[model samples]
Target: MSRKNRHEEHEEHADESWLLPYSDLMTLLLALFIVLYAASSVNISKLEELSKAFDNAFSSGISILDKSALIEAEDEQNKSQKQRHEEIGIRTQQEKLMAQEQEDLEKLKKELDQYIDKNGLVTQLETQLNQSQLMITIRDNALFASGSADVKPTAQKLAVAIGLMLQKYPDYEVLVSGHTDDHPISTSEFANNWELSSQRALNFMEVLLQNQAFDPKKFSFIGYGEYRPVDTNDTEAGRAKNRRVEVSILRKYTDSSATNTVLSAISDEANSAPSTTTSN
Candidate 1:
């Protein structure tokens, strides 16, 4: 009975150690929840206090959470706006350039048409304004004598007048191409019409280059003798139409660097040797 009573007394006196830490933990958690609730209520004074406390505890200079991210976002927005403005400016300039080019092309076409109409040279010359270029066509008989590479004196005057007109617009490239009928020739001067046609084109180009306003470097000539004829050789009229000289004027705004490279290459090839005709 005595041992039983002592055991009961010892059990009664045992410390409640678990309750103390658990109560402390509960109080801390309650305080944390109450602080969080106060912060969520948008109390400006409490938020500032919390921020100051954290800054002091962490030894931080700035209080904002994502300063770098906000700055980067603003910078990207500014950059995008600047790019959009630049794109709009470029589009406006391009539109103005296109309009000016169209006006220039129309003026050139009208001048050629008037000249042809006044001189009664409709059968000899014609002009075209297509998407890529402006073309002026001159019949072979009008520019050259039969079986000859030499340009006639009257043809020289016509070419000079055309050159004068071209002088007004010096930015365009001049391409003088020669075409011939299907009749084969084996003369001492020319082995075939290809040689003759090439020479004639060169001769025309030389006359055009004589003008002080025209740039000799931009002039090029090619011969397509009997190969790229406009009409068949079966009929006289068709043959007449087939034998001709053509001058194509390229626009100024069409990839200036790339066009100049191609023109340079063509000039080198034409200077090296006469090109052969391939059937179209």
Candidate 2:
């Protein structure tokens, strides 16, 4: 009875021991397959999740595949953070430049206002400073006689003073715009108001350009004729107000058109320069 019992117990235990080694082999294969799959995908989140599952099921720490994925993920995160910070820095710098430009224009406006006040020319001149530009408006009577585009001798001093002040801001672009009353004109010297207005703007700009302190490339002129009127032409006072010239120092941020104008001016100058032949 004892021999039969011992033999049966030994057989049962031998089959059970074989199953333990076979189970260990299957577990090792499964771990190898999981690591290979993780290597192929290379996702940090998925790798961590799978590692946590393996840790719960086994006595091991994180796998090599999971660690590699984690390293890659950290690298990508650092790159993304760096790029975002760079973009923010660039945006902040742009905002700072725009604010500085506004401050400079405001300072110029104050100086012009002080000069106009000291000269007692408030009736004939006015200054306005905004985000887009700093403008000085001069009444027609101060610069020219009736039906004439010629700048008065006294007005030349005013233009010189303005041109000198403009030298302080060498980076800015200046625009001299001429406006006229709604009344039409046709004369031997001028064909129409357009011709008169254009001549007036050109002549005034020529006077300002005489000061070598200012860059010729920075100045441009336009004659609006009677189209861009700020006041009604129905009254004498309003008509007088409309007949004026504006000297504008344009701000760069809100003035894309001004940049195009400046670029166009540069192109024109480049094209107008006389070509010379070079001998080889």
lDDT of 1 by residue, 1-280 (tens): 9999999999999998999999999999999999999877887898899998988756755435557778888999999999999999998998788678778888999999999999999989999986556889999899888888788999999999998888888987788888888877777788777777788889988888889898788788887667677888989899899888989887776456654654564556445533443221
Name the 10 consecutive residues with the lowest summed lDDT in model 2.
271-280
Against the true structure, whose TM-score is highest? 1
Q: Candidate 1's C-alpha lDDT?
A: 0.82
- What are the per-model C-alpha RMSD values against the true structure? 14.9, 16.2
TM-score of structure candidate 1 = 0.68
What tens digits encode model 2's per-residue C-alpha lDDT throughout 151-226? Answer: 9999999999988888888888888888788786767787666566667888999999998788888888876667
For candidate 1, the per-residue lDDT at 250 reads 75
Off by over 4 Å in 1: 1-70, 254-280
